[model samples]
Target: MRHLRSLTRTLHKQRIEGVTFHFDPHHQHELSTAVRHFFTTPEQHTPLDTPEATRGVFLLEGERKWVLKHNRLIHWKKQLQNYLGLKKAFGLHDLTNEFINLSAVSAKSACAPSVAAFGYKGRFPFLKEEYLLVGFLDDHCSVDDRLIAHPEQASTLLPQVFDLFARMLDEGFVHMDPHPKNILIAPDGQLRLIDFECCAHSVIDHDFSLGFLMGYFFHYWIKRFIAMDDYRTCCENYLKVEQPTLDRSIFMPVFERFLTGKVSRTTRYAILTSPKAQAAFKAQ
Candidate 1:
């Protein structure tokens, strides 16, 4: 549960030169050695194949497993999205989006994997990259794909997915890029989220959170993972859990946009930019 607690609580945040480091107060001795091993022996790390738009390495030392989520140092070239005023919408903020989202979630929550440490400057030597440390899991895979292959599993897992989305709506944060790949299925059937870059989505208008949910559930045109009817049923289930008083008519526009955009090149854009999705955000 230490990993699930407030990241700023036990970790001592320090800055050396231009790099940042977080030392675990509870495991100072163990963290010191593990951090060094992860940074210095990058070659021994095995790369995890992420279908989501993310890249990271899995490091093993003795019996511990750690996953280091990484991103290259930013340059003026990386600022083009900012110039276009699409930074937050695209989750390109300097603060790692995953950390931002995870920090807002309750420690006992099952929505995401607990992040261990933040701002680890990797030893690329020739180039620099920032990493977020996450405790490596034992056995897990994409929950979305697993359901498609084993429809029977959906009987129990589908409701859990809907419940998670409803809770997120009530909580106010939204995961911008809604890809099934971001959700993982544990051996016991619990779900966990990973690859947090897209958590920084939507600025003033919070309605897009619903769009995120729609895309997350249906994946719309990209993979056509879930049918429109299935998504509608999901919406109904969501309304019951998050807003039982609201009628289905409330989501018509979002549904219409998704259906129309499915054929158009702008389906993704349409879903994220719509004005009636209604979920507010608590992440700062």
Candidate 2:
């Protein structure tokens, strides 16, 4: 139960040419070597395939598993945002934001991975790359994989998903990307959320509207791999856990919008036509 607040309070900070490096006091001994190896000889580490370019590499030392997330800071879209001052508004650096969010979320729950260390390699307004080291969770499977493997477990697992969302909401937090791939299902059936790159904190009265839930379901389940019946069951189960009186009518518009979006249109067509997607949706 190493809390982020305590860790940050004891963190060792070093500044070089506007680049700031934060190291966990406990792991300072291994920090330099680990950072060197992470950047110079990445091939020595095991590559992890992530949807985004900020992929991770696993570094094993004795029995410890450290995941080094290499996040590139200079991208065309980010550059445009920087010019528009949007980067400053949202702390647009992905790794920095992820580290901050992870620290905040870890303060609330044990769902987020424990951050070991984080640093930016270059100066602001022209920052190069950023990196974050975190402890890896073993024996965990993505929620998407679990749902596809055991669709029958939806009735049992959907409650856990709802509970996690409820806890996050109660804590005044919201995961901008609520995709199944970002959620890990532990062997003991606990739900652990990962990838805080897009997470945000909100006011206590933040809206958890049916529209938001519908869009979440569409992006995480329906557009990917889920049967119509199971999708309905998920919605119903979520309502059972959150608001029993609210019906599905309020969410239909969100679903309709999801279907009409360009990305959703292409994804829906692909899923409908692909044999693999069809098979996964029909999985039991």
Candidate 3:
């Protein structure tokens, strides 16, 4: 039944006002052919996500790639989970709001992929998906990727990672998810953040609470990314004279203990399923 539904599924593209594209060469018309191909050539798509009835694929644009993030109905198991209160309900994916949030956080610490084109598919209430096309960023890679290739790089990158999170908090922005894969190291050494689906920015971002941000990003970063020996350096970078937000006596021990209690991000990212990535992980 689901297969039949998929075979006949129709997409209804929508246009929203005030939305902009990062690609300058009229990305909409330019992407039309590629978008059509994406729907038609299912076998060619390099699967980027899990078991999903809705599609998510890499759309090509000449030399570059873009992410076609489609939001569609959840599976019956997921629906059952929601009904049983065993999991949170999956919400709608609104590309327009995501773009606005991206714009707000640009240049602060990280960035979302520049949206090339986006819209809704099918009717709204159900059996519909809202999607956006964003460029597959080049000249950079995720922090986790960098670490997997060179575990030794952890020492240097971990401190910069902490600083980036701290900078975001200072600049009135709070990212709900700054996980290793979501944080990228740009070519110029600037950190770029992706995945703004759960992120936010505000004039008074502190309403989200700096303490929670610290717990969410900083200490969590330690357990996931920073090694035990590197904790002091990250703490120092974050609590230097210019930014005297937390007391040394309070912050250092907490971070050290956090490091002690959990595996660093470097260790966790060291293991990979891909032979190439695993070989790189071993090479370092």
Candidate 4:
């Protein structure tokens, strides 16, 4: 059976070159203990990225560039464990395919290399997933770093980012992680979107086009975070430019029309089941 095969793979920790794989459900605890010891006194220092709600990402480089994602200290073995734990989880759209799939969907979509996934060895408890043999980005700094250094540039860059957002929504994918840090611009000045760990598909009408999505996102981003020096005046201008006498609730019909026509079954199922979506939809 597939479960038996998974178990067998779990028992034997396989390593190819510098990459180590841990998918064992049984030996997770033992493997975690050993890994912690090894990592604590690593032959090469392991750099820690910022902490996230779900996991801690680490930067590793020796033979190659890699981003290692360690457990969040509490959870089931895999990253998808939380999503799978929720009701109608199986019916939810699979974001695991999004990283690779984005390339085909859009030329602007860029992502960090995903070389491997690890869990645990033998019958231990605790899961660790390591990404190995990744290719480096041209300019390694994240958008957050860039913005922190050049706040004035926010006006220019944020617009381009909103464009990216619109395109993804029009294309029927909702990039759940839109933080500035997740986007990277190559040396060639081409934009790339990275980190698909929380990506999901949404219902968007085919006719909606990337432009609509981008414009909306740009406004939303500006409203939520970015505050240009002229922000107060600009916001007043925006209100005047796009004046709407109708109540906000009137937009629900418009949103549903697009969602029902454009979104896939998988996305629809996820939207219906997810608590996040439930609240948003209810409010709408």
Candidate 5:
């Protein structure tokens, strides 16, 4: 069942049971049917073990691999705020935010995936379900996997990892969740970023703090396996790439807070107690 119809200039749209779908004309031929089936009969799709978002894979022989992100309604409080017109919350619609984020990031970086199609499966003001289909980078492993298998390579890889974040920051974007798992290492040794569902755009004209970026690295990388010295090397690499004038001294407070568990209890507990973090700790 081909559900998509042409709009204009590489755009196509489809509507099914109150849900609307948008697709790239270049990929319409390959994506239309698979997208329809993935949404209409989600139960048949096997879920992928993604840490941040619910995902499912729908592979086709001799074709590009497709991964569908099932965006669940996790931030109810934010959704409520959006509904009440109290504040515009980004969490109200995860798939839509990701679709937009991916588009913006793709325009600036080759490392981000191209969104093939996106759709929502509910009425307005109370969207119940949403999904995004994207071209999967086949045979790539998460940065976490690579770092785990070769702890000694942290010095070599952390700089490349920081470079990726530096580029994104230079492009006026912050990947609110730039954890190791959300970043992938392609067979060619290039770093590609995925899972932009929590990404946000920052003002290009303003000087930005490295607090959030450092926090994510500290939580996912330093706390898990990377030595403090290697992590500092990565931070210096990032400074050289993006903010040469900024003092490394500024990072110490945040870094020490994270290291000493003096940061917010919620964030500290979540990172230290997450199953992925636990597994990484056990493997050490």
Candidate 6:
């Protein structure tokens, strides 16, 4: 996997005026004409989407819609390069496909529309990804979207979310991004984890530990700023939930692993600011 450290090397070699010739086998006929027009005489390469790549929405026949994410390397924005690199190295497309397959295999009745991966199609050094289309939840709101209206769900959602984390961990995969935006709740109250862009495989316990630590602190961050009591209740309640399962004292060592800076900045912030997190420090 290409870590983000190599971002500079690729960025320095970029030629705003130069173009690297390549071909797409899947859309050979259509992409050939389109790409040639973008990079013809004058050798001008069309600018890729900005920091958060342009999310192109195209409606397919029969109500199926496609969101085209042109994950390409462009010289103008440095951030796009890093995001694209991570997206490719981690094989997000494959992971998501497996997630969809799991939903089918498990035969879970929850309805979030199993994510379908259309397979990643990218040219080396240039990334362009086409995601497998799914039925969009028009009425169902993301957990993040719901929080704006119902802050009270913090008490209700956080603990349940921790349970979800524990379950995923027990299942041997870490849902890397634990933020509310990636969780979608249907009208039936079935919460589905979406966007497995940063997941990884791990031993069952380690995966659960990492996920639990991630969940514990993630909610604590918001709870601290807006709802302190809820945050405390969440921590205390989680301890209650986890206590009967194991040594009842293993949450800290698991948390310290993520604090080492390998995790995302938001995650780090969440861990550092958690109220119960200090117990881990005092223990050391």
Find the candidate with the highest TM-score and give its number. 5
Write down the TM-score of every candidate. 0.67, 0.71, 0.62, 0.53, 0.72, 0.54
Q: lDDT tens digits, residues 126-194, model 4?
A: 222323222345456666677778767766675556455545655556554455767776676556666
Query: Candidate 1 or 3, higher TM-score?
Result: 1
| Position 34, candidate 5: lDDT | 73
Model 5, C-alpha of 107: deviation from truth (Å)? 2.2
Q: Weakest 10 consecutive residues, lDDT, candidate 5?
A: 1-10
lDDT of 2 by residue, 1-284 (tens): 11224535667876534445677778765765566655566667776564365545465443466777776655766634432334432223366667777877777777788888876654334446666878778889988888789766766666677677666676766665666877898989888888777655542222323345355655546455656566666766676668665545544554444433433433332333344643443341
Q: lDDT value for candidate 6?
A: 0.44
Q: List candidate 2 segments past 4 Å from native.
A: 1-10, 14-20, 50-63, 75-86, 89-93, 203-211, 220-224, 245-284
Residues 1-284, candidate 5: write the lDDT tens digits: 02122212356777755666677787776677776665577667655563354434454322566887765555665444322335322322366667766866777778889888777654335545566878878899998888789877776776777677666767766666677888899999999888876655553222222544665676655557776776766776666776677654544554555544544434432333244542342343
The C-alpha stretches of model 4 lying farther than 4 A from their native spots are 1-43, 46-48, 51-55, 72-134, 170-172, 202-225, 228-283
Give the per-residue lDDT digits (tens) of candidate 3, residues 1-284: 12222211332233333221222245555566566666667567665566366645454655467776765545654333322334221121334345445545654533545556555433312334445676777677888788778767776876676676667767766565576778888889888777775554542323222333344444555355555446555545555744575554434433344334543433322221123543443344
lDDT values of the candidates?
Answer: 0.54, 0.60, 0.51, 0.44, 0.61, 0.44
All predictions: root-mean-square deviation over Cα?
7.1, 9.4, 11.8, 9.4, 8.5, 10.3
- State which candidate, 1 or 5, has the greater lDDT: 5
Q: Which stretches of candidate 1 lie over 4 Å from their true place?
A: 1-10, 13-19, 50-55, 60-63, 77-90, 93-95, 106-108, 120-128, 148-156, 200-212, 220-243, 259-284
**How would you encode candidate 6's per-residue C-alpha lDDT over 1-284 as one tens digit per residue?**
13322322222222222432222233334433443343343123322223344333222322232222223333433233433443332223333233333333223423234432222334444334433333345556777778788876767777666666666556555555566776777787767765544444433344335435554445434443346455656656786667455543455554444433255544433333343543444355
What lDDT does candidate 3 reach at residue 190? Answer: 85
Worst 10 residues of 1 by lDDT: 275-284
